[model samples]
Target: MEVLQILHMNKGNDETSYAQNSKVQRKILSVVKPIIDEAVQKMLCSNIAPIGSMGIADLGCSSGPNTLLLISEIIDAIHATSSCSTSFTEFRVFLNDLFSNDFNTIFMSLPAFYNQLKEEKGAGFGSFFISAVPGSFYGRLFPAKSLHFVHSSSSLHWLSQVPPGLDCQAAGKALNKGKIYISKTSPQCVLEAYSLQFHKDFLLFLKSRAEEIVGGGRMVLSLIGRSSSDPSTQESCYQWELLAHALMSMVSEVNT
Candidate 1:
């Protein structure tokens, strides 16, 4: 499937856009801050030899407040611990996401972002160079052993495409009817199909990232998954059922 050609979060700062709806993601970032801080500290300290530059990539780095904010946090951690370390004098930050992501919005925000970094770091932040690399993280986006730190939040739950065995459609019947994802109403096959897709995509993601990240590198990720073995568990699957009901209600109202 050409999943790479179509995956993108909603754009802009409007009510319906990802920018406005990313508070949950921001909260996840906050929860993971200490981990991030520790990772940067260790990455800096582990560099016994001068490495010239530190390469950092934020996979699924959708554009918005969290984008530059996360970068700022990482740089601060590095400075607090390794500002004087000649092992890494420069920082290369890669902001990566799908091709259709609103890179323009991120780019426009850069002028303000750069100014804020300078204001906060007092010109020492001048060492950080940022760039956009739009693509899927399910595959390799960086060269081998190039990145020292990686970060991704609220992005990996998405599969490259709809799971297999779900493509079955006849004249009128739907395999997983009246729902957008695996729900209580869905059959066992639907759950298995979805799980299989996730396993395939996630494995590929790890394999790809493994090649790009350097020795002693670290990655921080936040994704949606279930603690239970059963995929039909309400805690993991109820939200989609509710959404389906809401969507069908709207459709019924329009039709009537």
Candidate 2:
């Protein structure tokens, strides 16, 4: 039993790690690309020339292979937008994420991405200035009305932490008794805690982005979401469920 428990705990840790890694900020860029393009087109149509150093940001930017890919798309969108107009302004990008994120990986990749940008000229894909910002998107990470465009994906769904009011006793019993994710039969306290966290986080996201984006600036967000309005439907991605199961398995193993 002790050996089984240890194995489950290790499996859970891997599952959780896998879940976090696969949900980087870049995955949703394509989903919102059309919106970004339209926003850029509008800026051009409005004669916003010399775009005056447009500020772009990617929030909840996790460290992974996909991070740089999204940055490139954003630069392309900006230049495409700028080209339609006469804007020749230098572009500055802010890549934002939590302090604990693997910023080192992002930083190390910058020189190559920057050098490539330097090589392109007189095109939307050309030059761009980039910086990695360490912070949470839920808080004020940018200056007042400083951003012209913002992008975030697979990030907003994350609660800062697990909900506080979850009934540990209930959660423990569920795992010990061989239940999976909190089901419809789960305790209301569990569901309420999760719902409140999501609601609070969503509101914070709106307020912060609203304050940072200029009056006509654009903001794009893509995230994992529940298929139904009901929180107990358990229709989220299988990866998420696998991670949750791993967590419970780990907990039960340790107790044995």
Q: What C-alpha lDDT values do all the predictions have?
A: 0.84, 0.66
What lDDT is reached at residue 110 by model 1? 91
Per-residue C-alpha lDDT of model 1 across residues 1-256, encoded as one tens digit per residue: 3877876778998899888888998998888888899887876777544457888899888988898888988888877885545567788999999898899999999999888888977885447789999888988899998898999988888888888667687456778877889898887888888889989999999999999888788888888767998878899888888998999999999999
How close is every model to the real structure, measured as TM-score? Answer: 0.91, 0.77
Off by over 4 Å in 1: 48-50, 169-172, 249-256
Taking all chains together, the TM-score of candidate 2 against the true structure is 0.77
TM-score of 1: 0.91
Model 2 clashing residue pairs (backbone): 50-87
Report lDDT (Cα) of residue 193, candidate 1.
87
